[model samples]
Target: MTLNKDHIGGLIFLTIAVVYGYFAHDIRMFPGDQFEPFNAQTLPIALAWAGGLISLVMLATAGRSAEPKPTLVNLDFMLVGKLMVLVWLFAQALSWIGFLAATILFLLVGYWLLGERRIRTLLLASIPFAVGFWLLLAKVLDIYLAPGKLWQLVLGA
Candidate 1:
């Protein structure tokens, strides 16, 4: 079978997903049950395995598909650079800006950089994403993301 861009891309993604799952599976579990019938780490482990399995299926399906011409690996330097800078900023500000505010800032910056137009659209899209992401990490995950010094001093983290 001829290996095209689709097949190769799928294969790489699958491999990375499997590797991520493997590492996640190796972490030590927390002692004592915080929630009934479920430990803190259970969902993460389940998600990792599911991701790995999905990737495997994707790779298998791509391998069996019809081949197309390979496309050149052109990097979108501007987008990549912007994303990287934003990610770095997020990491640096995580301990200072709290979860919700930092998430909103990142989402807004990301949306604008990715060519999203309309102030209303950007505002609408960012709100849910920031709130949902914060809720997921803080509540469902039962993990405390750094609420930042400002939040800590104000809200008492």
Candidate 2:
């Protein structure tokens, strides 16, 4: 049997899911801290299980197709590289600019890079998302997010 992309991708996905699930399962929770129904490990574990199941289905159906394999020439390596660089920059900026500011910048730049040229739309989308997510984490979830070193220095807070 010929090994197709699906087979390889399925195996990789399944392996990642298993590893992620394993690590997620090892998360430690504080004693008597049961305010929330879901803990830190909940989302990761759920996503890992979902990914593993989908990967298993892909692996099972991979050998049933006899169609001609598609070439990789259509894949845009430059776009992928740009996205990778953006992700790295976002990670670095998170500590420097904090979550809300970094996320807003990331979303704006990411949308622009992906061909969304409307400034109004970008502002409408990114600002609400950044603020909503910040509120969700900080207010609703009672999580503490850094207000950024730059903001701290500038505002003298």
Candidate 3:
């Protein structure tokens, strides 16, 4: 009846791993003979096992630590709430705007939300990170990322 934070957290983690592991296992990663020696399934299986191990560690540590019982305060709800909302916004924006522009907007907004006040820091960091990621994905990886209409016009595309 009385579930401690450790028990609850471990339960949540275990549940996630079980659900994810099921889906990961269900995917037919590669054909039989043609499969690479280390196929896609290996990574998912490793992740599932690692997640389980981490959950076990969390359970053990929570039980042994003398720290006071966990409460809502221990979870840092405000920061978590902001992070979740930011992720949601980023996902929605990613489709309409290209990856680079959306990501740059995301970084600026996230920095502002996190109470970063320096304009120089925001501009300097956002520009390079956004441009570098785009260059790496587009040029180095031989991948094409969607450039929003605005960017196309700006870059003469």
Q: Model 2, range 12-35, lDDT digits (tens) per residue?
A: 999999999999888887875446
| Rank ordering of all candidates by TM-score, starting from the highest | 2, 3, 1
- Find the candidate with the highest lDDT and give its number: 2
Consecutive 10-residue window with the lowest summed lDDT within model 2 = 63-72
> For model 3, how does the per-residue alpha-carbon lDDT over 1-157 read when each residue is reduced to its tens digit?
3467787788799888878888878777545823666776778877988998898888777766555556675677888799889999888777667898899999998898888989999999898999998899999998977766666667878
Model 3 residue 53 lDDT score:
86
Q: Is candidate 2 or candidate 3 better by TM-score?
A: 2
Which pairs of residues collide in model 2? none
**What is the alpha-carbon lDDT of model 1 when measured against the actual structure?**
0.79
Alpha carbon lDDT at 153, candidate 3: 66
Clashing pairs for predicted structure model 1, backbone only: none
- Candidate 3, which segments miss by more than 4 Å at Cα? 1-3, 6-68, 148-157
lDDT of 1 by residue, 1-157 (tens): 6776666777776777667667766766565554447765577667777767776676678766676657556968778988999999988777898778988988888999999988998999999988998899889988877668987788875
Winner by TM-score: 2
Global lDDT scores for all candidate models: 0.79, 0.89, 0.81
